[model samples]
Target chain A: MRAGTLAPGKRIRPLLLVLAARDMGCNLEQRAVLDLACAVEMVHAASLILDDMPSMDNAQMRRGRPTVHREFGEDVAILAAIALLSRAFEVIAIAPGLAALQKSEAIAELSSAVGLQGLVQGQFQDLHEGAQNRSPDAIALTNELKTSVLFRATLQMAAIAADASPLMRQKLSYFAQELGQAFQLLDDLIDGCKHTGKDVHQDKGKSTLVQMLGVEGAERRLRDHLRSADAHLADACHRGVATRHYMHALFNQQLAMFS
Target chain B: MRAGTLAPGKRIRPLLLVLAARDMGCNLEQRAVLDLACAVEMVHAASLILDDMPSMDNAQMRRGRPTVHREFGEDVAILAAIALLSRAFEVIAIAPGLAALQKSEAIAELSSAVGLQGLVQGQFQDLHEGAQNRSPDAIALTNELKTSVLFRATLQMAAIAADASPLMRQKLSYFAQELGQAFQLLDDLIDGCKHTGKDVHQDKGKSTLVQMLGVEGAERRLRDHLRSADAHLADACHRGVATRHYMHALFNQQLAMFS
Candidate 1:
């Protein structure tokens, strides 16, 4: 019952994708990149479904409700995650506006990020090291998996839809990746200090930045990343309107969260 | 680790890909398809790795060796699997002699198969009804995940590579999907009756054809699938020299396995 119990997430990634496309001058409708955006969000949701399973995090609650596994059992949770991921691709593949080649490109980008190197790798790293003693590097690694790579991919996919210039595309990627790390750092900070609904001090054995460098150091790392992310956004400003507004809004929110 | 373990699998899928290319007069070196072929095999391997995890089959052994998780622990096993998967895409994306768009197509095809609709979906179906009583439909659903979709993807990908006629491609896909199902049926027959290194009857509560139909009925289904796979291959015979040999060889092996 993930469809029912789980409050829907922010849906920010897809919005960024569509907004980026608009910046590039492409007209995105429900049948176009909007469909793809949903697909990407589905992937994100699937990751969370799997992540919160008994075998993984064993998390009891998520988004203020029982996780997919808790609501439907582990098997159904796994199946639901798989269903969402597959449907994500199918929806995008069949979307009206994407040409065969473009469809191919979109699938590749999305899959690569979600696939072994991106999300799965990140998960493995997190679990492997999370079980061990704390270290700054360990926390950095987790951010990459749980956060950065996907952010980079989200922007890249958006750029593909818009056919952004290579230089502009690279710049956007830098922005997204850094921002993602910053976001994850904030998440960890929250998770570590406060119990929320799940386990507290659960990351004790893990190589968290906080455990390694103390709270002060982890905060510094996140702040530095925020500056870097903002710089990339400023660079994207040279591109045009849609890109500028999207970057500005996202960064401002993140910056405000930290402040 | 996989490099040392990477012996020639049946090489059935790769050969099909090459033969399909030949049908379109797309002759390339063994080296050209080597990376792609390896990538394909890696995908297969990654699925196997995930399938045997403690969370899934909980098998202690596979292919006569301690499974990846058993040897390296679950965390590392997962990472190794992810590494194989990501490297597969990297291989396809960077394979020599292909244009950027073509490389992108290869990566996309592989990704689609391994992502939601392909292997992951199959895994979901396998786990969805965990610890529950088996039914005929549940068995069929398991087969859909554990076998058919990837086989369909393999042949479809071959056609894409060679730019095969739509009619020819359709026939080829039919051959591969049916053959794959038959192979899985044979696998169940072998596992249910003789295999000892597995959880065997404990399919985490999901049903198999052998479980639902009994050994005799499952055998009949296997035979039927084999017959269809053979007929499809025969229809695809006029395509090319390589295509004919590849199809014939695959059909013969399937027959030989049961005989």
Candidate 2:
């Protein structure tokens, strides 16, 4: 679990969560937000471990090192993944200074993101549908399931922690959805690039938006998503400059590789 | 997830939870108790799926059918296990009539039972140490981790639901530990027996109490545990006749296989 979670990587999901919480005007102590952020990252780490298993993506490298299943045996890898997942919930359940109701809501949000309707469904679809001639809508839905669901959960959790109004939560949800789609598109665009420091050509045979739209068209859609995400952020939170700056910097860094 | 969870089985963990809750004078509506019981069963089902994976026990059969990974692909099976696990917490988090604090406590208990201090550590030790020469104490500790920890959590959750006194909770914990040990020992004794369903001889060549102490000695030890469990239960709850009867019937049925 330590090997998988403590590895070097950009914690983009946690950053998104923290920024969203701040943008939502969360007044909780730093520890509470950090705990929730860590929980989100742990969930991400657990998903990545499973994705790299021999039975899944079967990648050899992750974050520039051997995958968890490669470094440890498969049994250990599976157990570690579960341990991390369990720990993620445990952290939330015991997070100091948060109301029990808030914690329960957060757990509900995060668990759904990891369960049948979220990562599990997405991964299953990707494995079963990726190589098939999937329709554009089907591919986009899978992308949303794979990526946007967790992002939605992250922002929702932040909203819950912040006790934000339902309207604000709705706007943030839209923002997360657009941002998640853009992030995945960026990932698809850079699938085989070197500086990414992980497996290359992972989508080589997969039926992704990038496959159907071609590079230039895909980049156009990516920009559209970014624009929509920015609009939603602007409507949801006036003081979201940090979030806007971080997102643009991150996306530009990835897109610059194409240039 | 359905294939793994809805399969026919005794559902002993859930039964134990319900009975323990009743024994503790839990006054919640039956729905809340049932939901919690289902959550416990889901966790057990998820564990079985992973335990029967090719990398673990590699068993081909479970609950009189092909193991989950055999019936579903490994990827699906893995996802199903995770989904079940996530759903377990989700169920607890949303259980009606449970106070937010109680629900949080239950989630914490269950998650820890599944994490490093419980199933993960136990399985790791078993995989690494079961084949090696291990002391009786070492084997006992492993049994506590693998089996008793979840039982402990179940009873503790019941106590929480009932809002039972701390002293009563401690007694129930003792009862659960003893019962869990006896249950594992009985399972070890029944290895290679056909009427038990599932794959037999799962402990073959492994260093177990059954191997070290032989059949009669192990059976005697099992009896000792049952007796201790009974004593603890009697001390903890005066209105526990139903729990006592169910436990006796279950254990006697398993022990009768020897006759």
Candidate 3:
């Protein structure tokens, strides 16, 4: 169960979580913050496990190796994914030194991110992206629901751990949302141009940012998102500028690759 | 998502939760208890969604109709099941009139029941049950983890909601475990003989109590479980007698069918 998550990966979710914790002036190594980071990473891995299943993407490789379902049988992959998901919640619930109210809040935030109106619905939309018209607004909504919300959840869980106010939480959510959109757009560009991953042509029917916005238009949107994320960070956290610097350094690498 | 759960079925788990709540002197109509009942039902439905997938049991029909995967396609079914799961936790986390401690406890209990050493592992064992020796202990452990633990979780969640004592919770766990084993054994017998549900013959390779013990022996063991459950209830609940009566009435109907 832990193999998929503990395997080599970028772990952007966990990193963002720790960054969010830092933004709130909390210790980066706070037990609750650390555990929540692991929780989101595990949840993210579980999602990938499902997304890579034969019935879904049919991808034979991920995280630079055979996907879980490919390495193990489909049965193990499914069970392991579920186990990871449940464990993610357990990690939050049993995190040492966390208050009960905050624990409950974190659970609620995570559940809301993954449940009916969040990842599940987003995945459903993505699956049908080919059948639908996939208008720019639809594509954006799909990206927001499918990707941004989980990112929002990562930061929001951190905010709860730090005892951040509701207003601060809202600003952090906006910051995460922009970051998530930019991340997905960069992914699409990479997949489209480099064909480094799965057969990108197989997903040709699905709408992508590069297809919706011309290459230049998509780059413009990515920059706009970065600026929005910067503004939200400045308003939301005491360490906003520092966080923005870290994010810019990270995004710049992707942007360089995109261009 | 509710559509899947609200579909007609036995709904024994949620029923047991409500009864357990009543046994603890809690109002069955309380919003928290009621929402939790719905939550358990939703989780059960979600499990069915996965269990019926072609990769797993390949069950074409469930709940007297086409299974979710068969009806809505595999991707939708998977997403819908996950949505139900997250929705279940959300229901508990946001449940009104519940204390933070109890809510967190409930989440932990439910997650543990569904996580690494629980349903996931149990399902893995079931897939390999025939490959292993299929000893009585093996079969029993498989049933305990896959089925009984969830039943235990249902009662455990109810105990938390009712503010029941540790001792009371332990007793309820035992009651649920025995009840769960008995329920599965009875189901095996029913499927073995009557063939009312899925193609039981197709599952002949799977270990079952009816196979280990003769039908008569399985029935005997079920009776033993009921007696054990009765003992636990007597020592556990302040209103044990009434709860026992309700269980007896319910069990009798099932026993008559099994016979």
Clashing pairs for model 1 are: A86-B116, A86-B117, A134-A207, A135-A207, B122-B145
DockQ per candidate, 2 decimals: 0.25, 0.91, 0.86
Please give the range of 10 consecutive residues that has the lowest summed lDDT in model 1 chain B: B192-201
Q: What are the per-residue Cα lDDT tens digits for candidate 3 across A1-259?
A: 6668887777888888888788788886577889999999988998989988887888877766788888888878888888888899899888886899988888999999997667877777788775566778788888888889999999998898888999999999889889888877777777765535444544566777788788888888988988898889889987645567778888887677756
- How high is the TM-score of chain B in model 3? 0.94
List model 3 lDDT by residue over B40-122, tens digit each: 88878888888778878888767667788878888888888888888888888888878989888888988898876678777
lDDT of 1 by residue, A27-74 (tens): 765367777777678778877877776656778777667777777766
lDDT of model 3, residue A32: 82
Candidate 3 deviant stretches above 4 angstroms: A195-202, A240-242, B195-197, B240-242
How do the residues A146-168 of candidate 2 rate in per-residue lDDT, one tens digit apiece?
99999999988888888888998
Native contacts retained by model 2, as a fraction? 0.91
lDDT of each: 0.67, 0.90, 0.82
RMSD vs true structure, all candidates: 4.3, 1.2, 1.7
What residue runs in model 2 are displaced by over 4 Å at the alpha carbon?
A27-29
Give the fraction of native contacts in model 3.
0.89
Interface RMSD of each: 4.6, 0.6, 0.8
Return the lDDT, model 1, position A81: 65
